[model samples]
Target: MYVAVKGGEKAIDSAHDWMAEERRGDPDVAELSVPQIREQLSLAVNRVMAEGSLYDPDLAALAIKQARGDMIEAIFLIRAYRTTLPRFGASLPVETTEMACDRRISATFKDVPGGQVLGPTFDYTHRLLDFALEAEGLEAPEREAGEAAHPRMPRVTEFLNQEGLIQTEPRPDVDTAPRDLTREPLELPAGRPLRLQALSRGDEGFVLSMAYSTQRGYAKNHPFVGELRIGTVPVEVEIPELGFAVEVGEVVLTECETVNQFTGSKLEPAQFTRGYGLVFGQSERKAISMALVDRALRWKELGEDDKGAPAQDEEFVLYHCDNIQATGFLEHIKLPHYVDFQSELELVRRLRRETEGRVQQEAAE
Candidate 1:
């Protein structure tokens, strides 16, 4: 058993004070504002929101500032703060089909109903570091805004569904509320909804690693990006008095849908299966990684042969996915374990003494 050391209150307080001063840096330097972080460090804010399981940009930005740009730390702050917030009524699910897409692309098809809109992507940009950015107040060059090509672009999966080339997704009851792991404890052998929620809020690095493993032939389910889209979708809530759903607000989301290969079986026909990923904000990498991992987890459900892969192991992935939990357990080792160490030390010494006594007795004999 680990016991905390006493009489460190003053030292701890002093350390905290020093940390605060360090976080602020030089007095002459301009302080970073929450708004600036929210707008400028949008990706960091997005990641914090995704991992923290909170959607507020301002709060996430504030956490980022407080954590001194440490993403995992920021996520921890946001998650801690989120627990104190009062619960509002659950909002109706946003319709991704009706999304006002900013960036939409498909690797499976060259051309679709709406053309591939490469909106605000670094995909084609050179990796060279721009020295101009090192200088302050440099304005980014802007191009003329184009008119919207399509109001509601058709999903790539729909095209496959039309031709019966892919497995059809069974729509769940719209009114039925999905189980929230935040409110209730996570139970083993979780349903897709629960698993998805966990994965969506999971550590990006962990999910990415699991996804990468599948790609590297650990659990090779040949996957192709059916479509990846980043856009704002309207969030609606059913008004009790009005008895109708009204649009409350909108949230930016990155959605990735993967098409994976499945062999034909005696009972089931050979068709491309779908793996879905939806995360808050413009996180293509996280979203894509999530999709791949989601597909890998569904191997048992999909009736595929289990290859004993880590990604396929639900307990292993789910238990280790949360960085906060993982970090907390790992960081706990720094705490004083004096009693435990002392016990082990005594046992070792006793064993050595016993061995020495036995050797002396044998010599005497």
Candidate 2:
């Protein structure tokens, strides 16, 4: 007698065991410590925090290791971890003006109140791979000696304000309703707050590609980064008992401002147009891209002519984003669908009969 296929549960159990072993790698080699991953794989950790909307380096590292260096999987892990955690409460909006900046720069101005501080950037480094790193090279260069610290960093926007260049964004009062993307389904024509939230957790690669498209004449958006900043913002929570805002914790943020030159309309004279981007972590490229996209989407709000650009379309920008959402919808098509297959079969059978009849008539002729 023929034996039927077996080990459904057992096979799954064994596969999981094998996966765990594979993730850890060779038993002979020393296992990677969580702290080591956190310190060394900082960029991966940053990506996880940025995409996952969670900020725990150690956990991010663990997720990275488990994911076998897949940044998306690491993000998924962080997202899953975050979902399980209990929410204490929402903190008051961060005071970005009070941020103790680590790196502050502006492309718009040569001389601002706070001088440009280029801190810890790989932008200038050569793209060549070092052979020494093949064997886990030691004796890396130490941190560069910091020059004199600037007292206060006045925002590059402040200089624009002095010149009355761009429109001033109104600070939200406590009574202002925040449109929550998590609770409510995303609606068309997103406001700045909702758009910013989507962008912060968006796939870095996707945003980069879309931003690149804008530069390559797909959308004629000439964007120059007005300002890019990496710093910590103080997170305050209003203590009901104390009746005041108290500093609970802090988070690293990347803020970007893009200034686009706009020739004016009949009502107003020529003015320097603007875009704003703010995100978690120190992603300058992503932040800058977000700013440019933000400006493009604000065409209607600013009363500028809708050039029908992809970036200018509110529905296009808000809907076709977020890697997690994109990936899920895309991969879902791969799942089992016998019902669809039966429908396809019916269509194919009808087509085959029609084709045969046509072939027989042609043969007779």
Index of the highest-lDDT prediction: 1
Weakest ten-residue segment in model 1 by summed lDDT? 1-10
Best by TM-score: 1
For the record, the alpha-carbon RMSD of candidate 2 to the native fold, in angstroms, is: 2.8
**For model 1, what is the alpha-carbon lDDT of residue 134?**
77
**Local error of candidate 1 at 157, Å?**
1.2
- lDDT by residue (1-365, candidate 2, tens digit) is 12323555567689999999898899899998889888887777887888888877788889988888888878888887887899878887776777778888887788877788787788788988988787864887776566535356877877777787776777776798777675577886677888877777788887776677778765566887887888888888888999999987788888888888777777756778888888777788788878877777777766677777787777777777677778778888897687999999999999999999999999999
Q: In every candidate, how many clashes are there? A: 0, 0
lDDT of 1 by residue, 327-358 (tens): 99999889889899999999999999999999
Local error of candidate 2 at residue 342 (angstroms) = 3.9
- Note the Cα lDDT for every prediction shown: 0.92, 0.79
> How well does each candidate superpose onto the true structure, as a TM-score?
0.95, 0.90
What are the root-mean-square deviations of the candidates from the true structure over C-alphas? 2.3, 2.8
